[model samples]
Target: MKFSACLAALFGAVFVFLPAAAAPVDAGHARVELISERDAALPGETVYAALKMDLDDGWHVYWLNAGDAGLPPQVIAQPSSDIKAGAIGDIVWPLPHLLPVVEGEIMDYGYNHQVVFPFPITIPEDAMGPVTLDVVADYLICEDTCVPEQARVKLKLETDQAEANIREGELIGKWIAKSHVPFPGEARVLKKDLNWSLSLRLDGGFGKVRSIRFFPFGHDILHPAAQPVELGRHGATVSLSAADMTDVSKPLDGVVVIEQEDGARTGYEISAVEGPPLPDTSGLGPVGGVGIQVAAWKLILLAILGGLILNLMPCVLPVLSMKAFGMVSAVSSGHAGEVRRHGIWYTAGVLVSFGVLAAIIVALRAATGPITLGFQLQNAPVVAILALVMFAVGLWLMGMFELGTSLQNLGSGLADRDGDAGAFFTGVLAAVVGSPCVGPFLGAALGAVMGHSAPVVFTFFLAMGFGLALPFLVLSFVPNLYKLLPRPGKWMDTLKQFFAFPMFLTAAWLAKVLGDLAGSGAVAWTAAGAVAIAFAAWLWQREARLPRILAAVTLALTLFGVTERAMAPAPAIGASSAYAAKYEAEPWSASQVQSLIAEGRPIFIDFTASWCATCQVNKATTLKSKAVHDFFAANDVAFLVADFTRKDPAIAAELARHQRAGVPMYLWYPAGSDEPQVLPEILNQGLVTSLPVNP
Candidate 1:
C-alpha cells in the first residue's frame, strides 16, 4: 500500500549528479526560477519542469498545502500551442518544517532554504515551432513577518540544440524523493467540539517515529493548536484543533510527516473524509488510563541515571573494575594528558557501542514488530560468543599469555597497542558485558523511547553510555582520589589477578544461560571451548613456531564447534519464558491477559529474559519469595511471565505498548482495572507484597 503522492513519476535509483542553474528572479528573501530537466524537447517528448525557490537564511515560503496561514506558491504555466501541459498539478512539494509566527502565535508549514515544486509537461504529436512557455510565479516569503513575491520566467520547449540537462534532472529527482508519499490506507476525520481527530493507518517499519505531524492544505480547518499523536498497533490518531465548529467540519487534506528516531522522515499526503476515526489499537487517550505518555526530557534523564547505575551491575563490574584501575594507573604515573585522552577515547567507545545498538533497533523494528534493550543477548549464538569472549578475558587476566599491560586485558586484547586503544576497548568490553543487565531507572526511560524517534532513542542511549563511562572519565581527570591508595606494586598485580575470577564466574553464568537456551550439550561444548581457549593461549606463548600454528588451528576449531554444536532449544522446557522452575509462572500472551481480566483476576506480569542479570536477581529474591507468592495465591492474581530470552513479535509489541525496549518490566493490574501499573525496574520484597488485593 505504499503509494506515491505525486502525479508525476518520481521513483528512481539514487545517483550523484551536478546541478544546472538558470537566470533567476531575485524576490527579496526568495530567489525564484522556472526550469526543466531538458534544455529542449521533441514534438512527441514529455519533459519535467519545476519552480525552484532558494530562500535566504532564516527566511521561508509556503508549501502547496500551507497550513494555518500563508499561501502556496502558484505557477501560472502558459505553454505555446505546440506544447501540451495540464494546469500545474498538485505541486510536488518537499516535506515542510513547522514555523511559528510569533506575532500572531500561528503555526505555518513551509520550506526554509530551498524547495522544488515539480510538474510534468507533454509536447503534442503535431508539428510546431519552438515551444515557448511563459511562466508567472506568486508566493509569500516570511521571516518575522511576511512579503508577497512574484517571478516571471520564460523557457523554450523545443530548439535545435535541445538536450537533457543532467543537473536539472537530478535536482528534480532528489526533490521528488522528499515529497509526500500517499497515505496508503484509509484516512478519516472525526470531530468533537472544536477538536478534530485525523486517523491514519501508519504501517510499521517507519523506524521510531520522532514526530507524526499533519499539515492541512487548507486554511481554518487546522489551527495553530498543538497536534499530538497517539501511536497504536497498526496506525495512529492525531489530535487536531480547528478555529471553530465550522472549520472542524471541513475535510482535512495535507501531508503527514513521520519522522523516525534517526533523522529520516516520510511525508504522507492524506485526504480524510468526515467519518468515524480508525480503531485506536493503542487504547491510549483519556479512556486508557493516562497512556504511555511521558515527557521526553524525563525519559532522557532516566536513561542517564540508568546508565550510571549499570556500572555497578554484576555483569559489568569485573570489566569496569579493571578499567577503573587502568585509569588510576595512568593518573598515578603522572601522565595527566594520557589520563584525559584515555577517558575521552573510552567514552567514544561506549557511545559507538550504543550507536550499534541503535542500528540493531532499526533492523529489529523492520524485521520483527517491536524491540527492547538487551536484544543482542537474545540470540543463542550471541550468548555462546559472549561466553567464549568472557572465558578468553579470564585467561588473559590469569596471565596465560602476555600481550601488554594487565590493564590491556580489560579491553579484550585491543589495548596493548601503546595508544589509548586499550582504554577505548575496555569501555567497549564493559558495554557489551553490561548489555545483559538492566539497572535502576533504565526500564521506563528505555521504554519511553521504544516507539519514539531514532534521534531521541540515540540521545537517551548516548546519555546512558556517558553515565556508565562518567565515573572512570572523572577519575582520569581527578588524581587526588587515587593518591590515597598505595603506589602500584605486587598488590596491584594481585588485585588484577583477583578480578580474573569474576570474569570466570561471569563466563560460568553465561554458560548456564546458554544451557537454558540450548541444552546440556551446549554447556558442555562451551566448557570444552573454554578449555581449548586457555590451552591455545598457553601454546601461543611458546617459542616454537609449530606450537603457534597448532594453537591457531585449535582456536579455530573450538569456535566452530562451540557455535555449531548447540541444539535447537527444547520447546517443552519453555526456553522463551522465565522463572518457571522457581515459581509457577504461566507463559504470558495478550489474549490470556485479556481473558484473565475478564474473569476479574488481578494480574502481575514479569517481563524478563534469561540473560538479563537484573531480571535474574529479582527472580531469585523479590519475585520468588514465599511471602510474595502467598500474597498472589490468596488474591487469585495471575502470574504471567513474558520472557524475552529470545525475540518474540507479540512480546515485542507488548513491550512497546508499555514503552519498554527490553525486559525486567513488572506490571501490576488491579482486579477491576485494565491498565497495568508499571513497577520500578528494580523489584523489592515488600514492594511486591504491599499491593492491595482488592484495590
Candidate 2:
C-alpha cells in the first residue's frame, strides 16, 4: 500500500509539471487552441490562458471594430457550472493592424498570420481546485475572399499550489503586453463640416515616429478616403471623412498606431472629447503611408468627359438639334466675326449657368445633406417651367408668332447670327436640362471632391459645362464644318416645322416627369396651364390692344398658377422602378445587403432614379432583358434597386463613397466577398452574366 501511494504521488507530480493545453481544432483556414499558462492554480489565484489562432499565410481575422467589413472573432462560451461565472472577465482584444482589404478601395482592422487573445482564468476563493472551460471560437477569415469558420476546444485547469512549469504564463504575459496601452495624454475629436479629425497628444514626442494611422472603433469612418496625417512635437492628427455619424456627441474611441524608423509599431488606445481646440499638427512634414491624396486634375478631366456625354441624353438632344440648325444658319449667313462671338457668348452662358448651379448645390448640401446632379429637377416647379418653355418653343417653331428684337432672336432658326443673347440663352437651357444625365467618368470625379471647397467644386463644374458646349462652340468657330450645312432655302421651313415635333415631345416628357415628381395633380394642372398658354399665343397674334392686354393677363395668370401649384411639396414615397418589378429585383436596404452577404449570396445593386434618362435606358434594355434575368436566377443572384428618384441621404452617401455624382451605379457583390465590384454605368447582359460568384 505504501509503495502504491508513493507511485501515485509521483505520477500526479509529473502530470502537474506538464503544460495544460487543449488539442488544436482545425478550422480550414486556421487552427485554434485554448491553452493555459500553468498546469494548475490554488484557491484565490488567477491562471493565465489564451485562445490562439494560427492563420494560414495571407489570411486574416477582424478586430472588435472592423474598419469597413467583417466581424470580430467571437467565443461561444456556456456558463461553467464547475467554476464561478464572474471569475471570467470580458475578452481582451489586442491592437489589430489596419489592412487594405482591397488597395485604394476598402480597408479593415484585423489580425493576420497569428493572434493571441488572453483570457484570465480566476480561481474562486472558495475551495475550488480543478476547473474545466469549453471554448467554441467563431471568426471570419479573409484574404481576397471571406470564409466564416469555427473551432471548438476544451481546456482543463488542475488545482495545485506548486507547479513546475511557468513558460506558458510568461508567453501569455508577452502577448498581453502587446495590447495597445491607454493614451497617456489628452485626446480630442473634432467634426468640421463633413470631415472628421482625431488628435492625440502623447507623452512621448513624435520625433522618432515614421508614420501614424488612426484605427477608429467604428465602421462609420470612410476607410477609402484620404487620411492626411499631421504631426507636431508630441501631437498628431488623422483627418478623414465619415458618413452616417449624425451624433458626434459621444467621446470617440480608437487606437492610434505609430511606426518607428526600424519598421516596428506601437498602438495607444484612447477616448477623445467631442469638442476640441485641437492639438498642434504643424511641427513636421507629411508622413509617408496609408491614404493617397485624390487628384483634382484627373477629376476635372473626367467631369469634362462626362459632361460631353450628356449631349447625347434625350433631355438635351432636342436642344442640340436646334443648335445644329443655328450653326448651319450662321455659316450660310456669312458672318465670321459674329460666328466666333456667338461661340464665346454661348460658352460664357454655359460657364455662368454651371457656376450658379454649383453655388446652389453647395448651399443646399451645407444646409441639408449629401447631394449632386439632378437635385434641381426634384422641384416639380422646375420641371413645370421647363415643360412650359418647351411647349412655347414648339409653338414658335411652328410659325405661331415671330419677334424682331434680341429676345425674339433667342428663338429664331439661327441662334448665332440672330442675336448674342439668343445663343447665350440656348446654352443656358442646354446646361439646365442636361444636369440630370450624370454618366460615368464624372461620377468618380465629383465623388472625390464633393465635400470639398467651393472653388474646387466650381472649377470641376465649369470644366464639365465647357465640355457640354464644346461641340456647338467648335462648329461656330470652324468655317469648314459650317460648309457642311445645306444652303438656306424653302426646305428650312419644313425642317424647322419637323424640329417642332421633337420640342413638343420634350414638353410631353417634362410633363411626365412632373407627374412622377409631384403626382398626377401636377400633370393635370400643367396641361390646363398649357391650354391657357396656347390661347394667349393665339390672342397675341390678333394684333389689337385689348386682345394683347387680355393675352398678357392670361399668360401671367397661367404662369403664376402653374408655379404655385407645382411648388407644393409631394408626399414622401419609396422610389419605384419599372424594371425592378419585371426583373424580380428587391428594394435596396443596408441591413438586407449585410444579411445576404453573410449568407454567401451574390448581390447586384442598381443605383437608379426615374429622372435619370441614362438609367431608364439601361433598364429598358440590359436589365430588362430575359438573358440577364436568367443569369440572376441560375446563379442565385439577388437583384436590388437603390432608387434615388426621391431624396435619400443614405443612397447619396453610398454614391459618394463610390465617387459617383448620381444614379446608374451598378454594384456587384459576389458570393464570399465583402467588397462590392463596381460595374460600368452602362451594363450589358453578357457582362452581368460573366461575373464570377466565387473567388
The number of the candidate with the highest TM-score is 2
Candidate 1: where are CA atoms >4 Å away?
1-296, 405-419, 567-578
Prediction 1 global C-alpha lDDT:
0.72
Query: Among these predicted structures, which one has the highest lDDT?
Result: 2
lDDT of 2 by residue, 287-390 (tens): 54211146667768877888889888877898887766666555556778767777787788888999899998666543333466888777788889889988
lDDT of 1 by residue, 562-650 (tens): 88876455434543355654569788755567667667789998888778888888988888889998899889989988877765545
Compute each candidate's TM-score over C-alphas.
0.58, 0.62
- Residue 120 CA displacement from its true place in model 1, Å: 41
